[model samples]
Target chain A: MVSKDELKKLAGLARVELPDSEIDSFRKDIESVLDYVRQIQEVAVGDISEQPQGVYGLMKNRMRTDENPHPGGEFSEEILNQAPQKEGRHFRVKKIL
Target chain B: MSINLEKLTITSAHRHLSNGDFSVEELVGACFKNIEDKNPKLNAFLEVFGDWKEEVKKAQKLFNEGGATELTGIPLAIKDNILIKGKIASAGSKILENYRAVYDATAIAKLKKHQSIFIGRSNMDEFAMGSSTENSAYGPSKNPIDPERVPGGSSGGSAVAVSMGGALASLGSETGGSVRQPAAFCGLLGLKPTYGRISRYGLIALGSSLDQIGPFAKSVADLEIVFNAIKGEDSFDATTLSEPGGLVLPKKLVVGIPRDLLSNPGINQEVIENFEKSVEKLTDLGFEIRDISLPNAAHSLAVYYIIMPAEVSSNLARFDGVRYGFHKTGDDLIDEYVKTRSSGFGREPRRRIILGTYVLSTGYYDAFYNKANLMRNLIIADFEKVFESGVHLVATPTTPTEAFKLGEKANDPLAMYMSDLLTAPANVAGIPAISIPSGFSKNNLPLGLQFIAPAFREDVLFSASRKFLDE
Candidate 1:
């Protein structure tokens, strides 16, 4: 089971701040959810299969070579005008780099 | 002859349009009139498009030019999550209250190509996260049949729009039972085609592998028409399968029934009786009815809760408020990201996101996400084994019960989640499933029976559904 401190650490990692009053409620909820998940861990398996079967196994490489690559110049100014925030020639963003 | 355009099925509208009995303008005008009259009470629409007059003119011109497609000039509502250029695609979240789509979704592009008239954008649970539209940050969509009752959601608005005659048909996306359950509640036909059958490009991601865009209509035939038009390979969505052409029905179909799985205590007696009657009608029509056991069916909801939230955590990670949507310009980068998501997303979205993040976290990944995926494989294998037994179609109640009163199950998330128990397994297995109006409940509300077919066997599903509707 995940401890309350571990849960708090997870909340910090996810950038969410739980209120002091609701922390206990959230702890119970998270513990119950984790308990439900722990049911999955109890199942015993001998030789685990590597290649996934069914829908997940149906994943195929979806690359396309038939279409020619278009140049960046093809994008119209009218198209660029739709951005929520744009600099002079490019889509603008806050300083993260 | 002035008829309620909202009440008329697409097939009837097509007949009238072809006979020159009614012009496209008249039809579009009637729908707009219906929306103006009904939307205030129903709250089905988020925003009615401003350029509808020009769109109506274009559709009329296309009809006059003899270039009208099957859905030409037909007015439809779109679920807010599917992008339609220049319209607010909020997905019922305050975070994206002002977000406008720069491009049309692939499905919307197809509809536009056919000159279909778009009426408006419909409401949904915030970010398509909840079973009840009550979770919508805007407001809950009231049931058209009974205003005091809920229109089962997150596709509640789309279903109500079709049910209440606001639009001839509407587009809705299904992650779990979003389409079928609401369609059942509203007495409309809803189809959740096999995953990847319709392109998801431009659709705000919910659960990537599980999400599918579908149609809600008054009849099985109308659903087929819209499905045929929007279904095909798209360059933007590589997952879409090539159009396999029209599917033909077999001489005799074997219908599978997981009777034990459906014997839930919460299920209404009337729903069970109606399902049995429908099965009997199918049997009388020479279709073979076989009792089958899908014991693992009970575990579908548990499996879905684990897998879906994990995907939700990943898909919604993009909405950190840096690129688009609600962004709080804080003192620093960390503050901005933290403040934005904390205030932007609703309670349900936050709860699921946190739960999802926890499940996919390093120490918990193998125990939760990985096990869920393995169980998902087992569920698919179960369906494959049933199909191998020569079962052409599987039948179950679309929902356990009819529409409950508004706010009845809203507080208990687990109770609301249980409502999708019958519908989620098909999604987990990635198969074609549909819900058609079965009969009225004891309260006079509608009941729906869902029929599912193996992957790429939409033809069989359609044929069987048509038969059931005819019977």
Candidate 2:
């Protein structure tokens, strides 16, 4: 079972502050989910040679050299106007510096 | 009028459009009428597209000019997570309650090229996280067949829309049985194409590696049309293969049946009986059916929960209130991020995000995330071994049971997750799977038989599914 302290640490990592009441519930909920995942440990993987890579490897060699300057056409300024915060032409966000 | 144009397949609709029997505007109006009358009970659409009238007008003009594209004038619904420029793509999350999409998903762009009419956006589990649409912040979608039951989700609304004839077809994204399970419940054809077959350029990320954009239709032929229209390589999505090499099915198709997997206690007796009947029918129709062993198949749901939530935690990191979505006003940005997400995301999303974060944390990554990936490779290898044995397709019941009552599994997330056990294997293996309406339960609710083909072998699935439909 997942402990309350572990749940709190997970919440911290996720950057969400849970209420006092929710911590216990979340611990139980998460533990149940993990218990379900414990079943995967039983699957024997003795003969598998190649790791399950995603589609990236399958299509990596098929790359195209021709980069169309604008394949589907440029986004209109009106579209950019919809951004929550805009500075000149680009979307603005919180300071990371 | 004799054709019940609402029920017409994509092929038939194209013929009618070419013959000038009906216009795109008329068809769009019919879809709107259906949504108006049925959406209230089904809770299918969160928001209908405002520009549908103008879109319909453009499609009608294009059709009249005799230069109609493949899906031209076809009314289609889009799952809420896929961006459709200048519309809300909330993914049924309150966090994105006011967020508007700034661009169209690549699939939507392809549909636009064909002049397909956008009817509305369908509801889903928040951030595509849950099996039942009950997780939607908006509310649950009731199965059209039986209002008391769930329409099986996160693509529940899309399935219901097509099942009840609200939209001619819909585009639904599946990470783990989202599309197929719901389609099975609603008695429509839902195909989860091979990962990367369709670009995920503007689809809201769920599990990036597993998520695939696919179509929901009343018939198999319609599914093929939509699949063909939306598939092809896109510069935006580098993962898409250059349209897989071969398209034809082998003369003697070998279908694998994991008899032991289906014999689990969790499977409903009626569903098992129906599956047996389906295998019998297939055997009589000249296709070879063999019992195959996938000993590790039971581990699929567990593996999926780990990998999907891990991806969810990473993907959702972008939704810090300062950038986009519903922001809970606060003195500082950090506080704002915490407050907004805490209140914005529903319980399930928060639970998953937290769980995912824990699994990927410093000390636990190897034991949880890495091990899950290793097991995923083994599951894919299991399929490979079966395929080497000449099994072109694998078949099973999409869900162990037909649509259960709306609130039956709502409170129990584990019970709900178990519903996806049979379907998750295909997603984890990255193979193409289609759920077609098999037969009805004793109560007359639809049951779907799932057909899974090897990666990039959608053509084989289409052929087998089409044959099943014909029979």
Candidate 3:
């Protein structure tokens, strides 16, 4: 079972706030999920080999053209337009100092 | 002319469009008309596109120029996760509620070349985190088959859009059973192609290794057409298969049924009975049915839960308040991230993120993430071992049971996670799997029998599904 402190740590680690109201409920659900999936830890894999994951395991060294595909700043405006706060060309964040 | 949208298949639509039975505008208009009527009731589409008229003009031009592909003027629902340039793709979350796509997803680009019309962005479980659309930030999409029950998700709304005649076919993504389960519930064919088969360039990533954009349609050929259109190595997606290779075909089509994995009490008896009938059908169609052993098969869902969330945690780390989307002012910068994310994301997304962080955290990584990856390696090897024994495909019920009531498993995270029991194995192995609507349950809810093939062997799934459906 996930403890309250552990749950808070997880939330902090994941960069999401664990509001006081949601802590207990999130803990209960996450604990249940962890307990369920923890069965994998006991699945004796002594006889098995851990192959590298995915397409890269089977095939590699694939390459593409070196030339840049898109023009510089082609989507800079479109991307910047979505920023919550932005200057002319930079995404503006609150002052750090 | 009113289009019988429910019965319209891509092949039929193409013939009719070529024969001048109806104009592209009429087809697109009829789709809009149906969506307008159904979406309000079903809560299927999150947002309908407004520029379908422009797409109609392009399709008509293709037709007039005698260069029309089979998909020209075909209206399709795109899952909210796929980015279509100049349109909003929320992925059924409030954080990105107003996040407009600046570029088209590779699948959308391919479909656009064939002049395919995107009807709208359909709803889904936020961040593709849950089995039911109840976790959607907007709302859950009601099942067209039975309004009270869930249309299996996170591709639920895409299935509903197709089932309710909003679109002739739709595109969905699968990390677990997202696409196939909903397709099963909606009485449609759905496919989860080999991972990397479809480019992930524009898909909102959940589990990067497990996620693959797939299609849902009423007919097998339609599903195949959609798959062929979107699948191929992409320069943008590094994981896509490098070589265009021929599908592995056996001299005699042999299907392996791992009976051990299906014996769980969680699997409904009705699903088992229907699966037996499908086996008989496969036998009748000249497939050699063999009972086989996949030692690591039962560990699929457990392995998937560990692996998927880890990737989700990493993949979703980019959603800070500064760049785009909903932002919240907090005490400081770090506080800003915590507040924006906690407020922006829904309960389910937060829970998964926490769990992913937990598993990937230093102390627990060896127990959970490492074992899960090793178990995944074993699962992959088991499938390879079976195919080596001359078993061309693996068979199982697409889901454990028929679609359940809207909130049946809402309170129980464990029960909801069980939805992916059968389908998760394919995703784990990065193989091709298709869900064919086998028959209906006792309550008249639809059921699907799935056939999973070796990596890049979607050809086997397509031909087998066609024969099974007798299309």
Candidate 4:
């Protein structure tokens, strides 16, 4: 079973705030899920490796001469408008340090 | 009301629109009426675009001008995850509750070129996380077939929209059975095209590598039409193929059945019976049914859970409250991200995100994430070996069972994960799969018959599914 500290660390890394009430439940959920997925460890790792095709593998790198037919900024204004906190042309956020 | 849209498939709706038997306005009106009547109880639609009549008027003009495609005036429901520029696309999450799309998804753009009228965005599991739509921040979309039961989800609303006649057809994205399982539950035809067969340019990223936008229709033929319209290469999505690969129907339809996997204790008895009946039906149609073994097929769910969450963790990291989505004030950046995500994402997505982060963390990465991918390669090889031998298509029950009651598996993440067991292998292997209504379960809920064809072999899937439907 995973310890509470490990779950807390995971929540922090995942950037999700696990409420105290739910931390215990999540710990159990994660434990069961981890136990289920633990079977992957038993499978022999050979030369084969893959990335999910729908996400990445099927896409081949297509090289082309750099030409600006349609500039990237076409939807810049629209995209910026979606920002929760924006300053003029940029998205505003809390301080990093 | 006189048109009886519940029986009107997209093809017939197009025929009526072309023949002038009914105007596009009347068809649109009929659909709206159905939505008004059924949507209140079913909760299928998140928002029915208010200006749909304007688009219908444009379609009417096109019909009058004599330049209209088969989908010209057809009203279709789009899953909330897909973007329609300037429309509120919440993706059934509270975080994006007020978020508006800046651009149309590539699939939506393709459909627009064919003049398919946008009906509305349907409800989905928040960020397409749950097997059932129960996790929707909006509310669970009830199955139109049986209101007390869930419309199998994350695309539950899309399936229900078509099943309930709110739209002629609908589109849903699937990262592990989001489309197919719901299509099965709602008794509609749902297809998950080969991974890159349809571009994922504008889809709300869930598990990016596993996500594919597919269509739900009343029939396989209609599903094929929608697939053709939405599929093809898109420069915006580097994953898409330049063109869909051609499919050659085998001289004789040989359907492979994995008996070992089917006999697993997790599957319901009635579902197994229904699967057998479907196999017998194929046999009666003179399609050779052969027992095939996929040694790693049982492990697909495990592999899927690992990879899907890892991808989900990475893909969803974009919604950190800086650019768009729900934001909360915090003392610092760390607190802001945590607070925003904690509030924005629902329980299911958070659970998966945490699981994903755990697996991808140092020390655990090789034991879980890397091992899962290696097993994924093995699973893909398993399918390749079977298909390369003689099987034109592999068959399974789309889900282990029919639609459960609204809250049946809501709290148990593992149970919900099991709902996609049969459907995940196709996504993992990057193959095309479809779920067509097989029959009703003992409880009178819908059951789906799933067919998975080798990579990019949608033609074979269509041909085989069409034949099954006709028989």
* TM-score of each model, paired residue for residue: 0.94, 0.94, 0.98, 0.97
Which residue runs does candidate 1 get wrong by more than 4 Å?
Answer: A1-3, A21-25, A28-52, A66-86, A90-97, B243-248
Q: What are the per-residue Cα lDDT tens digits for candidate 1 across A22-92? A: 67767666566566556655554334454566555665668767677777667546455555466776756
| Per-candidate iRMSD | 2.7, 2.9, 1.7, 2.6
- Could you give the C-alpha RMSD of every candidate to the true structure, in order shown? 2.3, 2.5, 1.5, 1.8
**Overall lDDT per candidate, in order of appearance:** 0.84, 0.85, 0.90, 0.88
- Which is superior by lDDT, 1 or 2? 2
lDDT of 4 by residue, B1-471 (tens): 269877898788888888899998998888899999999999999998998777888889999998899899898999999999989999899999999988889999999988888889999999999888999999999988788999998899999998899899999999999999999998889999988889898899988778999999998779988999989988888888865445456779899999877977999999999999999999998899999999898899999999899998898898899989999989898889989999899888899899999889999998888888788888888888898889999999999988999888877889889998899999887888999989998788889999999887888888888889892
- Candidate 1 lDDT over B162-201, as tens digits, reads 8878789999999998999999999889999988789999
Candidate 4 pairs with clashing backbones: A55-B209, A83-B324, A84-B324
Interface RMSD of 4: 2.6
Clashing pairs in 1: none
Docking quality category of candidate 1 according to DockQ thresholds: acceptable
- lDDT, candidate 2, A1-97, per-residue tens: 8778778877877878878988877777788888878776665667555454544347564556777567442665655555556677675555645
Candidate 4 residue runs with Cα over 4 Å from true position: A45-58, A69-74, B244-246
Cα lDDT, model 4, residue B78: 94
Scoring only the second chain, what is candidate 2's TM-score?
0.98
Of all native A–B interface contacts, model 3 reproduces a fraction of: 0.79
Error of 3 at B176 (Å): 0.5
Candidate 3: tens digits of C-alpha lDDT, residues B1-471: 558999999999999999889989999888889988888989999988898888899998888879999899999999999999999998999999999999999999999999999999999999887777989999899999899999989999999999999999999999998999999988999999998788999999999889999999999889989988998888888888854556455566899999989997999999999999999999999999999988888999999999999998998899998998899999888899999998999988888888899899989999999899889988888898998888888999999999999999999888999999999999998888999899999999999999999878888888788778888
